[model samples]
Target: MIIAKIALELTDLLVCAGVFLVGSVISFFLFHVALRRKREKLISEAEAEAEVLRKEKILQAKEKFFQLKAEHEKYIGEKNNKITQSENR
Candidate 1:
């Protein structure tokens, strides 16, 4: 009878240990999947932000170029006017 009781206890302990190991493995897998998804989301958001910044910088550069072009054209017009006035005099 004592031997039978010892065997039963050993079996219960092994079952509990097996359950604990399986639970741990499942938990690890779930956490790994969640973290991977979060990482992907962060990477996508960063890429989108970079694209927006690139577009804004391009627009600002174009605006600056147009402003400079207008200034140059005005300067040339003023010089032409001066030449015409001197010729008429």
Candidate 2:
């Protein structure tokens, strides 16, 4: 009877250990999947933000170019007027 009890207890302990191992493996896989999803989300968000900043920089550069072009045209016009006046005199 004592030997039977010992065998039963060993079987129960082995079943419990198997269940624990399986549970741990499942939980680890789930955690890894969750972390991967989070990393992908963060990367996507960062790319989107970078795109927005690139567009903004392009727009600002275009505005500055136009402003510089207008100023250069005005300067040329003034120089031409001065030359014409000097020639007339």
CA lDDT of each prediction against the hidden true structure:
1.00, 1.00
lDDT of 2 by residue, 1-89 (tens): 99999999999999999999999999999999999999999999999999999999999999999999999999999999999999999
Task: Write out the backbone clash pairs for model 2.
Answer: none
- Report the error of model 2 at residue 10, Å: 1.1
Model 1 ranges off by over 4 Å: none
lDDT score for candidate 1 against the true structure: 1.00
- What's the residue-level lDDT of 19 in candidate 2? 100
Score candidate 2 by lDDT.
1.00
Worst 10 residues of 1 by lDDT: 4-13
lDDT by residue (1-89, candidate 1, tens digit) is 99999999999999999999999999999999999999999999999999999999999999999999999999999999999999999
Clashes of each: 0, 0
